[model samples]
Target: MAVQDGPHQASPRKEPGCLRGLVALVVFVGIIYAIWWFTGGRDGDDEASSTPSVSASATGDRGGSSGEWKAGDCGGPDPDRAPDGYEAYDCGDPDATFRALKIMDGSILPAAVQCPAGTDVIIEVSMNSGSDVKPSGGIPTDTVCGRNLSGDHPGDAGAGGGQLVKGDCVTADVEEIACDQAGPGDLKVLGLVDAGSARCPSGTTDPIRLTIVVGRPYDTVCGREP
Candidate 1:
């Protein structure tokens, strides 16, 4: 005798929890992006990156000038020597030499030091008077060094490390900041009101003159200007 057919079973539908999980995942990502936007996306917190880029070539001071100012390499023997009427700070580690930038009477002078070829560094410039800098203009070039490191030698004093604002740390590299026109290896031009401008926009030296605290890796040296 033939057996009777059993009742047909219905296929199980997909669980509702799976759909809920997908929705939750999307919501989580949205929340994270919202937080980042509110925080100004990390680097955007400072004026260095936020500051507008302009041509320094107008100064006509092109390359390192002899009469108006003097330039010296940092991280060399006697890195502690401060230029006239200025002070020095130890911005580098024990294994490396420290360099300082001296500003006096609205003029910037370099304190010489010999740093490694690929060392990242930071240079801070502050007017002792907290004055707004009205940049006259100069050649927009890579870090103009006391000794020109162009062509093949790679010892151009131009800027070799990234740019740090006030208190960030860095690890400079030779090829990294070497010939680049901006960022770590880019040339440093004075007269522009970087951070001090917020305090003394009118342009009068109160006490500070561009103090560049070069931490090896320029980016870490200067904290983003909040």
Candidate 2:
């Protein structure tokens, strides 16, 4: 029998390289897609990555104290006993009120209240500086102390009210303070009655006292005396 001529057949071209390249491309694409899915795809909002700081809302039903304090009224170490240097007082909770009473006997004591995180503070200085000397509410912008600061009490007198803040103090020039004030997040200084002229009721110069209402954000200022 005549040798049957094999049907004409062409050798199959090797496409392994192409197949390998395609596999590699798929793997690369899959890896890139996985990375993208894990990274920037979590949050769908178009907003910037940074968030702004915001004031926290007041909680609880406790109303703060409305008056100043005497030296004997405070417990433990007096907040005003700064040793010839700067000392800081952290009054937690905005609803909580703090008072600093310093008995001025020729020694100068400066104290400040600090608000930690999410809180603003403002400080007012009030004191009975003995003499008839009155603290001139000085510059209009510097009236960040005493009464209502939001201009709610327009022309209202004394270390008036202002925005509360954090890390601020009310310095004193005299003995007794009425109601000190502060705003959230702001560190302020309230001017006390000048001890030089403002004398005490006893004829002996009185000490400087400061009352701080923590937690409320105010717009008042404790500016330097003119």
Candidate 3:
């Protein structure tokens, strides 16, 4: 069986990697993504509360909060329910009520919304996303966090948005470069490409198989291309 093609999207080529202090760039299907620097605003406890960290605060408001908090808020301990009125931090501290990493586009929501399964997305809100952005004009809304492309990698993962991915090419950066060497600053995932909505062609057979075109780019990188 031939390897099915996914989104044909390709990341834009930027300068070589490995420059400190330079903002990163990720190219996918021609779209470029910068860093994930949106700040979640101040925590919302009016009174004193426990200091909130990414982990501890993430679980506090799974149910959701009113628009009282914007996109960047993290919740502190429930002052009314706790033995002490104040959470770890007094009211007014950024994390006192909300711990913001970045602000998002949209109105505040009453509850946290979850992205559906098989969604072609990169970022999952580790903390609460204060506002829920609707599918503006019917575009669909996914957490815009996974914009950054870092961490240990399998070189290649399953296809997304119908794009066949492998190591670095698996990223929108399909071009050849010394990613392991580190230059153009750390790479980020621009977006998915080769977007074939249907995993298999219409009236196709089962057990869909895919192949990495030999002699294509990434054939020699890491010495493991098929």
Candidate 4:
């Protein structure tokens, strides 16, 4: 005999493969993430570690007396020093106005020093007071024998204006000037004579003597009247 029907209870619905499918999907996603993390994703960190750092001094961003300067290096006038001092610059840069011929220790006095034959100007860097035409006594000073690239005279520190090259044209007073600006009476440089030698090239009409500093052997510039 059938019993009286009690309240019918719904059995719990079971997903046959839904749970397993969800687990597999989670594992697949994790594997993909792991592969990405181990391969291309890790390259960022490796590249960051391998990259080289740029120094402020090399780019002349320090903007003051602090930086590495050497012979044959070119530079511009430092704005901080205003009418004096020098800042690092690329030789090929248009702003480059001076080329270093020699660097001397501070122990020597600027008055007692003689720069190289081709040096057109001199600059003094004081360790205690930045860059100055004159350094305070007893401090570390760096003397820069520089060749002025600009045609203008570099104040009193300059011997004259710019140093003359073989192809340069100069005025009758022995001042270097632009070739195009040369007048009918201007002279053209034929060659340069050594410090000890007085004889210029065979065709040199004028042998002009050039002096960089006191007591140093002077060079002779051979020039021909234009």
TM-score of each: 0.17, 0.16, 0.19, 0.41
Give the per-residue lDDT digits (tens) of candidate 3, residues 80-184.
Answer: 534212122323555453233333332122112222222222222222333532211112122221111223222223222211232222212333233344343
Q: Among these predicted structures, which one has the highest lDDT?
A: 4
- What do the candidate models score in CA lDDT, each in turn? 0.28, 0.26, 0.26, 0.53
Q: What TM-score number comes out for model 4? A: 0.41
RMSD per model, one decimal:
22.2, 27.8, 21.7, 28.4
Deviation (Å) of 57 in candidate 3: 11
lDDT of 2 by residue, 1-226 (tens): 3334468754456467656877897899877754553233434222111111111111111223323322212111123332111112223423223222222111011122222222112222222344221122111111011121122431122233222222223233211111244333222334223333543233222233333422212213333221
Query: Which scores greater on lDDT, model 1 or model 2?
Result: 1
lDDT of 1 by residue, 111-208 (tens): 22222332233222222222321132221122222221223332323333333222122122212232344453222222223353333333232213
**After superposition, candidate 4 runs with Cα above 4 Å error:** 1-68, 71-77, 88-123, 126-161, 209-213
> 1 or 4, which is superior by lDDT?
4
Error of 1 at 153 (Å): 14
Candidates arranged by TM-score, highest first? 4, 3, 1, 2
Error of 2 at 117 (Å): 32
